[model samples]
Target chain A: MNFDDAVRLTEILLGFAFAQQSIEHFKSFPNEQRLFIPRFVLAVLLMIGFQTAWVAGLLFLSGLAMLHRFQGPYNGGSDRMSLLVLFCLCLVYLAPTQRWQEIAFGYLALQLVFSYFFSGWVKIVNPEWRSGRALCDVFQFSVYPASESLRQWSKSPRVLFVMAWGVMVFELIFPLLLLSRISLVIALIVAAGFHFANACLFGLNRFFWIWISAYPSILWFQLRFITAN
Target chain B: MFHILKLLLPAVIPSWRFFDVIAPSPRIQFALLNSANAPSDNDYEWCEFRPRPAHLSFLQMLGRMFWNPERNESLFLVSCAERIVQQPTQHSEDEILKRIIAELKTNHSDSTGETTHLQFRLLLVQRQDSRLQQQVVFHSRIQSLSTQDKT
Candidate 1:
């Protein structure tokens, strides 16, 4: 974490993506999720888990309660089992370890790699997806509701062709971009634009934004660890 | 640096501990095995622990089928084998068809296969559907099951 990176982190904690954009965006969007309120509260109460573990435990449990409440009555036994297993896993992570923290960050990177590749795979296998209609279908997902102009543009043969190619190029070789250090920057920038456009255009909920921003940190962590190893 | 990342990106919660040293501004990873997780026990990366080959697990192989069924006909092959083994004598293709259908109706519910019972249940339906292709199991001389059945 360099000086600039430190600045980036402070803004993130303050719910600012970057200084200028954060201010502009914050002013525009007053009522979305506050990026750091809960964490900020937890940090202050627990003093960052340095002095008291209880505060961290309470915060973790409260979050779990909220998540469970949202799911509302598991109809399937399998889903219940999956949730139980997941909860047990989270408990295992709270143990203190310098090394474990490193692994946690690595897992986040793996999530990024897996999600892009898997999502791309899901698109590729579908015939509808291969022909480019899949992109339209995906865009229609509640995440990216196309505006009338965007919808009109989507129908153009040229637009469809470009969309088809873009989907394939972005998804098919997604994993490779992550693996190759030099290419990742390219992958990240394009992917960010993709998500940002989706968010701005369709009001798509991109939890993926937070997920991906964390990626830059992950790669830095991974490189350091590999060198140390 | 660690302190700075924490002081800065609190919502950016590091998902795993793997990047503690290099987290650009402190990082986050999800679904990781580490000491941050307690009660569940596993903390080391799979590479660090056991250090084994990357063979696919049984469930993983089954999941591949859901991607596309035609490519995986193992279920069809097994059904054909079972019919041949159980009623080798019933020759006339019509009689065999009847027998197979009967077997299917009687055994509509699939029995447990290794890890999860659901695999067998899923396979049963697909196998029944494939039987329409009537894939013959090589040369089997059916001498006439009518006489065998009645007399």
Candidate 2:
């Protein structure tokens, strides 16, 4: 993927994510509700790639305002990822040189890969995660489960163990996916599916969109360096 | 510069450590109290605030991907409660308490006759040895309650 294609793809995906988030914020804190209109407008402008640099800059500012309103991120990891993407996109547009733009987007892509690897690293180090106890606990007791019926999966320890290891191994080896085109496609698909399932079972819908928004940068990064090599 | 950095730090930095370990989940439970600063006899049982729905239709689940204000609000409350549990401070506690009271007032606007005060507690629920265990992590002092708009 060329740089422009990557940027466009990222913009479209991030726009959808931001638009949805703006609507969610309407039902959030009273102070935050005031931001919904600007955010929604910026999101639409972003999707259309209208005045790309200016729109991204304004969106970045809006994102910071949102951060201030919440005192941090209202939603933890998902909000963090969204901010990171916006920051990078802002730089991508405003950078004086193409090299700088590439560098900025590269940083975003690298962080995306590192996020998965680090998450898996931490989980593997924790005994509960390795023994599948963590997954069982999440299903049985975590407030994240979308419905009471979903908690029934906690009863099957064997299934939980397999699923837990499956997730950990996939995440741990995520960076390796960048080594080849075919592997990258498979990795993105698996990661999307993982996020999709989390949204379905845990009601973590935000994570699904925010994480997927960064995929274009990953695709661009791999094609630029790994495939060229 | 230092103050600006402190304000910006939480939003800019990403902590990718998600679900790294198993821990008990926090649940908010509140009880209605009578005028004497005690739980009313008739309302002795603590009701769970914003309990998760038992089920959602397939369409509702699909639609949530686009817009899910209620679930997001619930998650935000959980985040607030978790912060208080992790580090208790007057400000954090008071902030959550105020929000909880406001939510209760909005939801139970009809409770004007019997309940005059409200008390809430945080319960950490975890599974231990094939059974559920609940531990009270924090409890608040009884506060006056009124369904009438204070504004």
Candidate 3:
């Protein structure tokens, strides 16, 4: 994908994610609900590619206001990723030159890679996660389970162990996939499926949309930098 | 200036470490109090507020990606409870306490009219030795249910 195509796809995906998130905020306090109107409007403007630099800047500011309202991210990783994507988009559109835009966009791709790598690195170092105890505990006791029935997965220790290792290995090796276009495509597909399963099991629907929104940038980064090199 | 920076730090600096360590999850429980400032005997049983549903269909799960207000609100409550556990400040406690009271009033409208006061506690749930254990971490002082809440 070219840089412009990547930016457009990112905008569309982010627009949908932001719109969904805005609707979720309607269930919050009146002040919080008020913020969603402008957010939804900005998201629509972003998806339509109308005055993108201005839309991105306002959206970034709106995101900061939202963080202050919640005193932190309302939803942890997903909110952070959304803010990161907005920040990168702002840089991409507001940059003075195409070369600078590519650099800014590439930085976002780099951060996405680091997000997965760092998550895996932390888990691998923790004894609980390494032994599969963390996954077991998560399924057994975490408040995130979508339903009580989903917790049944905790009963199988062997399955949990293999799943734990599978996640760790995939995340640790994620950066290597960028070396080839086909490998990157396959890696992104697996990552999407992983997010889908988490959404189904934990009801972390926001993570799936926000993370997928950033995938186009990763594809563009691999094609432009990794393949070119 | 320092307070502003403190608020901005979380938004500006992203923490990607997710589920790296599975810690005990917090569950909020509430009990109704009688006019005597004590738990009413019949209403003494603490009930879990906003528990996850026992089951969800595949289509329901798929639809959650676009709209899931109940689950999002539940997650927000979890985040608030987590903050109270991690940082036991008056502000954090008050924030979540108010939310729980509001939720109880909304969800148990029929029971709220007769309930003059309420109290809530935070339970840290964890699995140990192949069994689930709940440890009470914080007990809130009795809070009055105002006329506004009853209405």
Candidate 4:
């Protein structure tokens, strides 16, 4: 197929994949078959406010998780590790301020900061991802079956390089927005862009939708929705 | 009591775990208790690690919808295969492929000779091999392949 045809075909395939995964995701109500459920659930819950309690419960639980991490039985943290984690996370669960700006900035900063640090950590381990060559290979692996005959632009190294740089720049800068006055808005746009790119470039449809869906609350700053309990 | 001991002694000393399971797919599970004298057999370990599906997340959902379409086909393809097969049996991948191919051949017309079946069997082997080299998700390839077999 031509470029347009390829794009359309990919969309159909993505839909099939999404429906399949969605069926599995909701099979027994929120399967941990994947990582990043927070991002997944939040991106999708972007539209509706009628289900305010559901979101509150989710954020409350996430805050609780932060608390539990340092104090629970599975807490295998060292003295220093425990102290450092507990100090930062306590602000999330117990802090008194409920301002839209602070809550939005803080929550967005925390989630992206954590994800950025972890993701950057993994990327740093591999030199190729940083330089952009590694990403090209990842794309090639997806279309390898028909790589010889097919017409996906992702097969090109230059495209992968631009993508790799885009990802790296976003990760490097996405957390900074959390510290700024207009940081929440910027971060929401970047997160949306990041997920949308994944949908277009890779066959990672669930990642795109779930991540985008979660963007609604983050997009509009509100301590009330972010912290239900 | 003596006969029972005789049976128990041989089984216990054999140094393997044998568990017979009766499910939709009736089968036996066995493991080696002592690797020192473990019976060297192919059935001991099939998949080094069981099939792990792609991660589930909002980000993952997004990836599926907008990015990785080909990656998504495997999910439906697996469901399609599951629906096609009446009796589910867990066997060697090759054996499963062979059985499905035979079923497809039987469903075809007499005008189509056994050559079609041979072509299908060959295609499955090639696809299976290519998947290993290229890392095609098992779920997507399985159904697509079986459909190729049937068609």
- lDDT string for model 4 (A1-229, tens) is 1222322232233223223433443322122223225523532442233243344345334423423321211111111122222222234334466453345334432443545445555564566676665554444332222222223443577876776666666666654565543665676677767656555443434545433322333333332333233
lDDT of candidate model 3 versus the reference? 0.83
Native contacts recovered by model 4? 0.11
Tens digits of per-residue lDDT, candidate 4, B38-74, equal: 3334433322111224334555444345344234433
The candidate with the higher TM-score, 2 or 4, is 2
Off by over 4 Å in 3: B1-4, B7-13, B36-43, B147-151
Question: In terms of TM-score, which candidate is stronger, 1 or 2?
Answer: 2
lDDT of 2 by residue, B45-100 (tens): 68888788888877878899888877887787788788889886564555556666
Worst 10 residues of 1 chain A by lDDT: A70-79
Off by over 4 Å in 2: A27-29, B1-4, B10-13, B36-43, B98-108, B111-113, B128-131, B147-151
Name the best candidate (by lDDT): 3
> Candidate 2: deviation at residue B76, Å?
0.9
Candidate 1 lDDT, A11-88, residue by residue in tens:
242122212112222211122114224434543544223323354454444334322322211112111222222232
Q: Model 2, residue A99: displacement in angstroms? A: 1.4
DockQ of each: 0.01, 0.57, 0.57, 0.07
Q: Candidate 3 lDDT, tens digit per residue, A1-229?
A: 8899999999999998998898777666677777888899999998898988898899988888877667777787788789889988988888999999999898889988988888889999999898898998988899988999888988998999999999999999999988888999999999999999999889999999999999999999988888985
- Top candidate when judged by TM-score against the true structure: 3
Runs off by more than 4 Å, candidate 1: A1-59, A72-95, A138-143, A225-229, B1-151
